[model samples]
Target: MSRPLGIIIAVSLVFLVGILQGAMASTKTTVIAEKLAFPWSMAALPEGGFVVTLRGGQLIYVAPNGSKQPIELSLPDLYATAQAGLFEVLLAPDFASTRELVLSYACGSEAANNTCVVKGNLSAQAPYSVINTQNIFTALPKKAGAAHFGARMAWLADDTLLIALGDGFVHREQAQQLDNHLGKIVRIHRDGSTPDDNPYKHSQASQIFSYGHRNVQGLIYDEQRDAIWQHEHGPKGGDELNKIVAGGNYGWPIATYGIDYTGAKVSPFNQLPGVKAPLYTWTPSLAPAGLALYNGDLLVSHLVGRRLQRFRYSHDSWTLTDEYLSELGQRIRAVYTSPDNEVYVLTDSAEGQLIKVELP
Candidate 1:
């Protein structure tokens, strides 16, 4: 967990008004745990506090008093290297009653690995433990290398799950193919069964709901509007924020505004006949990491840009209304807006932090 550039610092244990000049109305960030080991995602526990994932296969509980306690768990050997490691943790819709949750992580060897989802029940106390864990679903055609697992998960209104899978960096072309699970968003029941109403129910990759995504780090289900919004990382430029539609083609390597990392062309066109265009795009690559809605406003966190941007959808478009936490100079990994609209962010680094932003 070496930080090449170094970690970003900010005012700790203090509250400030109007943290930014150009935009934000009133926002403040309070650093909770300042020494996390490269965490990926978080979810608020129904009882209290949070359950966070450390890339090296550790599930820890963060208390309301800002204390950190590592929870012991029995997990299979994980492909925890580079960008491949433990990812998103999502509590079930009936978490309060069942104490069950879903977690997405990379599983397998260096030469062959794929994204996997597991269901686990949690204990009620401080020395927390995950019990009776079961593998629910796994992405098909395991890929080589360690980049781009895109393991973000969200539960829809009907209690089905949506898992985002990335286009393995070298297998970008497979994004347009439907026979494999790479570069697609799939829908499944809690028990790992493909939903009968899935977009490709009869295809080889029967669980697929949408295809043509790069590495989707941010995903959310807007229950109010019954919509799914996701953001993915692009090559050099062409990062996108898209409103997902069922069975839609998002046009990745097939049609993109971004060129290759080597500056070669990825495609001849940026738009295709049957491909869906982005609701909004970030040129020069903002490196978006998470997405959530705070009081009906969309909040996107970034790694390269080191900021939290707020957008409001009105009049048929999403507009940037404000930005926060950029002055801290940290790579914001995940920003989760709780059910009550409370904001939480995880900075990316070996000595990163879990901070709560008080938004008014």
Candidate 2:
């Protein structure tokens, strides 16, 4: 080859490499907010902002420009300890017009803690504080303990809300009984009244949509299918992703794929009559937290696994297609998709962060 031709080829190669590098850099993560206090959940505001909840019972309003301001929301009964605390925050479907929002948190004193949901309105002015807050729903038979407070919330319809409640750890057997609210998915109207058509409306277990859930943390409503998707943390290994059904029995302690933390078998049978099987199970337990369906894909944030997983549904089954952000090695507690389809994740740490995910 001639010298001039060699020089031209080398220059072209360098130019191509630089172009490739720039393209890769275009799809990168940007930290929107950092140094948070154990952020558990976040919801994007309709007007281009966010309302984030911390496990230590604080609410932070974040502006689009990355500025953070603390919002004072009164919660005199908030019980913040261990795995209990403020959990999920979500805006109403008609939030743009009503400025209404909802949140789930551990309420009551430490000796009698349980999951509770509050509905309130957001102020329009700066600081964007919460006002007129009312405890719309509270799990029954409030048991003691800081673990297993399944306080995730999802809007099943325009007028209905679904709140996931855990077994309260020590009362796992009550999950199979219909006399109480532990280990169940409860559905209620916006005013915290039982819907007229609930499956258990005529029974003693009114408001119970499903039972036998261990400690659900993630929930999402699929409008296309008119279904609810949820996930829960198991004892040692059996994490589950389930399609919730009315009056369904999930078989937590009665039929689990996990053993106790002490290495004792939780149940002898993994399959039982009249119990619904999980759509998916993680043997080693991913500690799945946030769940969202965006662009025909389900995105899951893992606390113990330390990754963001994308699952695609096709032919009535879900398959894992992508994994991301594992290099950061942070415990992701929540995932939210904005109206513009941008993904945001909250890390679970003293110096937690709100990260925006850029896709290629």
Q: Looking at model 2, report the run of 10 residues with the lowest lDDT sum.
A: 19-28
Point to the candidate with the largest TM-score: 1
The Cα error of candidate 1 at residue 118, in Å, is 0.5
Error of 1 at 18 (Å): 13
- RMSD to truth, every model: 9.1, 7.0
- Deviation from native of the Cα of residue 127 in model 1, angstroms: 1.1
Q: Which ten residues in a row have the lowest lDDT in candidate 1?
A: 8-17
Over 71-135, each residue of candidate 1 has an lDDT whose tens digit, in order, gives: 87776858898998899899999998898989999999899998999999988777899898999
Question: What TM-score fits each model?
Answer: 0.93, 0.91
Error (Å) of candidate 2 at residue 333 is 0.2
Q: Candidate 1: which pairs clash?
A: none
Total backbone collisions for each predicted model: 0, 0
